[model samples]
Target: MDIKTATALHRLRLASIPEALSFPALLIFGTGFRLALDYDKLVMPLGIIHGVLFIIYVVLLLDVWNRAKWPFKRVALFFLLAVLPFGGLFGDRILKREEQAGVIAARARKEGTVNA
Candidate 1:
């Protein structure tokens, strides 16, 4: 792929790492622990932070999907993984693998075009 597309994939892959862990962190702090442990001060801020990150991640996911020319199913699956309880880790790995495959295939296609 071109530099811009490649960059998007790279960024999305990186973002998935944090996106994976942030949900549970947000859930833990925003929910049970706060009431059970007396952390009222933390709820609003943590919820806000998680909301921002979630928004950012969704935007990035869409951008990467478009830039990478991904299938609708791929994008949908990624979104599903993003929202699942512990799906982020799997999502990150899947993105990494997909990104690598896309880059490699793009490189091969470019080489074939140049050779032709």
Candidate 2:
């Protein structure tokens, strides 16, 4: 891949991590506010925040999907991870691994070296 595409992929991957995390954080806060505090006011704002984050996560997922050309299973897995509590942390680790692998592969290709 060219430098620009690689850079964009990197940015998308990085952007996804925070957005993914935000969803769950808001989820916990919303749950806490609703169940423990018995407050409805916090629900709307937290819901809005989660909604926005969900949209961002989906958009980033699409960008990553297009750029990475990941298989359907992997794509679905990432989508699944987006919804589960603390799943974003797992997703972030996977993305980090992918990024590292891509960097290594790119370096190898650029250096005209083949892995065995």
Candidate 3:
């Protein structure tokens, strides 16, 4: 894919990772409130949001994998990272590195074409 498309897809992949990560954090606080504070009301909605975001993150991961033609290991690593605390941020950095490199190559190629 072209650099712009790659960058956009990378962004989506990175964004989704955080959305997936947020779910468990919310769940922890929500559960603590329910058990410790005895506040159970409206806790279920956070779960629903988390579920939806998790689904979206999975979908975006699949899309980026398909478009980028990433190796199985790379994809698996990213998926695994999502499960770890603060792992999503690491994955985002990797994605940004790949995206920026692609963009740089694209620019060089375009410049070469114009110069020729």
Candidate 4:
């Protein structure tokens, strides 16, 4: 794939991971706030928002993974990150770096700037 397509897919993949993760965290933390701190407040709204984002993230991840032709391992890692708190951010960074590296390598190859 070209660099732009790769980059876009990488972004979508990155975005999907965190969006999928936020819902569970909100549910857990919101529960804590209610039981431990007696801070009952508007939690359902957050839950609703997270739920929507989670679905969006999943769809985006699928699109990106398919277009990018990521290996099976990478695809698995993406799913794992969706379930792990803060893992999405790390995944996003890694994917971006990898995409950039691929773009650079492709450019180098096209220009015959590096030995193959």
Per-model TM against the reference = 0.81, 0.77, 0.81, 0.69
Instruction: Report the candidate with higher TM-score, 3 versus 4.
Output: 3
Error of 1 at 100 (Å): 2.2
Report the lDDT tens digits of candidate 4 across residue range 13-81.
557555756756687788777888888784777678777876676677777677777788887887787
Pitting candidate 2 against candidate 4, the one with the higher TM-score is 2
Stretches of candidate 1 above 4 Å error?
A: 105-116
lDDT of 3 by residue, 1-116 (tens): 46756766676655756575675677777888899989997489877877776677667777788878889998898877776666777788788777777777678778785342
lDDT by residue for model 2 (3-93), tens: 4446656766676666676766776778787899898788788888888877877787787778777788988998888777668778878
Worst 10 residues of 3 by lDDT: 11-20
For model 1, how does the per-residue alpha-carbon lDDT over 29-83 read when each residue is reduced to its tens digit?
5777778987687778877877777788889999988887889998999889888
Clash count (model 3, backbone only): 0
Q: lDDT for model 2, on a 0 to 1 scale?
A: 0.75
Residue 41's lDDT in candidate 1:
79
lDDT of 3: 0.73
| Residue pairs that clash (backbone atoms under 3 angstroms), model 3 | none
- Pairwise TM-score winner, candidates 1 and 2: 1
